[model samples]
Target: MKSNKRIILHYDMDAFYASVEIRDRPNLRGKPVIVGTSVITTCNYEARKYGLHSAMSVAKARGLCPNGIYLKVDKEKYSRVSKQIKNLVLRLTNKVEFIALDEGFVEITDIIKSYLSYEVFAEKFKRGIFKNTGLTCSIGIGYNKLSAKLASDAKKPGGVTFIKDIGEFADFISDKGVKLIPGIGKKTQEILGLKNIVQVSDVLKISLQELRSILGYNRGEMIYEYCRGIDNRKVSSESKTHSISNERTYLSPLEDKEFIWSEFLNLLVKTHKRLKIQKFHTKTLTLKVRYLDRKIITKSKSMNITTQNIETLKKLMLELFEEIDLEKKIKLLGINLGNLSENKEYQLSFKNIENIKKERKIQELKEKINNFRKNIV
Candidate 1:
């Protein structure tokens, strides 16, 4: 069958940041190591015993594991190691989609043919990563991305899992929590929980139309397919850029609307600059706010016409930003310019001439400032 022909592999680095730290500092191997300044980005398995996990507050994590080694994030070091692992993956197959620095999907249907079995290939690939980087990875081999991702997460710190049959995949997730499904975040989980749809099996009880009515159209349709072990997402090596975004997590949560707006504007300017540099016009502007309680809310506005104009984007951004509740202290603010299309040459209307001149002047000023800073450095 078509399902039997496809092979997808999800590769996840085990406790990536913490593992990297432990590898560099042998003394931290068995001890609980927590990485992050304000929020816990990740922790070693030893720390998990104390109910410590990603996104937990560092202060709370300290209370959980008082003697645990706390370390600040070293993004540059982790990124360098991630590149090394990527290079190793590229040597095996170029059909790879790296969703994050530590996790990615690879379509290995063609490459797996050279191996005696899928298990053998997974072990060999795991060994290659460990040999080169001194870090272990878990790999999930399956017929689709969803199954493969779940499989990879099933085992950790150097383990391989394979879910080849659709029936097997369905059985595996049947008793799992609905939150276990990708894209079903806390908000969706709460909504589902209201309807007593807590488990994967509970989702199966509802009809597609019922789910759509509950979650609107798109998300409901997606959940319907995912719960049935029917994901058709391709593992593309050269995926098109869908959005350009910038986000900042404050060391301390801010309550002042004016200060938050100023920070929000900075993110908008940075994101807009990237959009212009990439020569893409965006139709949708999204604002994401993360409250101190770790709950996140997003509001989005889609324009009738696509634009790269900073003024137009700024207006849209303000509209979305205003939708956020300022009564709650917020820890993070993010802006996303999406529904992107390549900027193509077109005859400008008289109305656009002044805006174009203003943008050019701004770009020139930025270039001059950057050059001056470089010279001084």
Candidate 2:
């Protein structure tokens, strides 16, 4: 069956941070573990079994698993280990792409053919990865990125699995939730429930238009193609994010205009810090908000010059936010920077030095805001 499923592999480290924490402290071996930058990082399988996950707050984590140990991320050490791991992976194939410090995708179909002893090859590769990085990863071998990712996840944490033939495809994925299909999120799943389609196999029977009308264009197309285990995206090679932005999901719904402005300021500051490090800029800042009942609204305007200053952008964000009447509390708020362009020095106008200085002040405030938010939640 000439399916679009490419010969791809999804590689993810098992409880990456927790494993690293355990590796460093042998004493932590038998205990449930948590390792993350904030409260949102890696939690051990034991904690996961208790319904705690990557993004859940630490306070919430403790409630679910009182015995779980928590530790802050040691990024410097992780980076050092990741570099060593990358070297070992390069031994397997030249087409390896590292998506983050711990996760990667390697295209190894040709290498698999060359090895002949694939299980031996897998074992050696696994050993090499572990010996070098002190991290255990799950490897999924499949016909395409999607299937391969799913396969890798079948057996986790120092586990490897293969998708040999398509006949067993249904069996492999039959018990999986529709949410695992990538495109079907919580909102979409509810929509699907209304329509009586709830499984990977169930998607095969829905008309494309029916899927499209319900999920919208890109997500619908993604479902239609992915159900057959087809994903054409390459190993997701590293690229500069096209735009930089930040958002806040209010701790609780908020309607206070002043409080909302303060939140926007904080976000702008954080986003500016990231933009500074990446050496990128955008031509526009977009302000977005959602109401308690799930009503979303957005506004955007282009800047005359490229900048990522928090103070400058906050003025714009507040201007946009203020335009919306706030009789009700806001459930979610976000900011987006778009119309990206590489950095270039603009010709400063002498006719408007005060205006230029004021503009520069906005940029400076953005820088300050970014710095201030670094240690904040």
- lDDT to native, each model: 0.91, 0.76
Query: What ranges in model 1 sit over 4 Å off?
Result: 1-4, 252-377
Estimate candidate 1's RMSD in Å: 8.9
Worst 10 residues of 2 by lDDT: 1-10
Question: For this target, which candidate reaches the highest lDDT against the unseen true structure?
Answer: 1
In order of appearance, the predictions have TM-scores of 0.74, 0.71
lDDT value for model 1: 0.91
Candidate 1 per-residue C-alpha lDDT over 62-141 given as tens digits, one digit per residue, 9 for 90 to 100? 99899999999999999999999999999887899999999999998888888999988998999899999999999999
Off by over 4 Å in 2: 1-6, 36-40, 72-94, 206-210, 213-218, 238-240, 246-270, 286-299, 308-336, 343-377
Itemize residue pairs with steric clashes in candidate 2.
6-143, 269-369, 269-370, 309-366, 310-366, 311-366
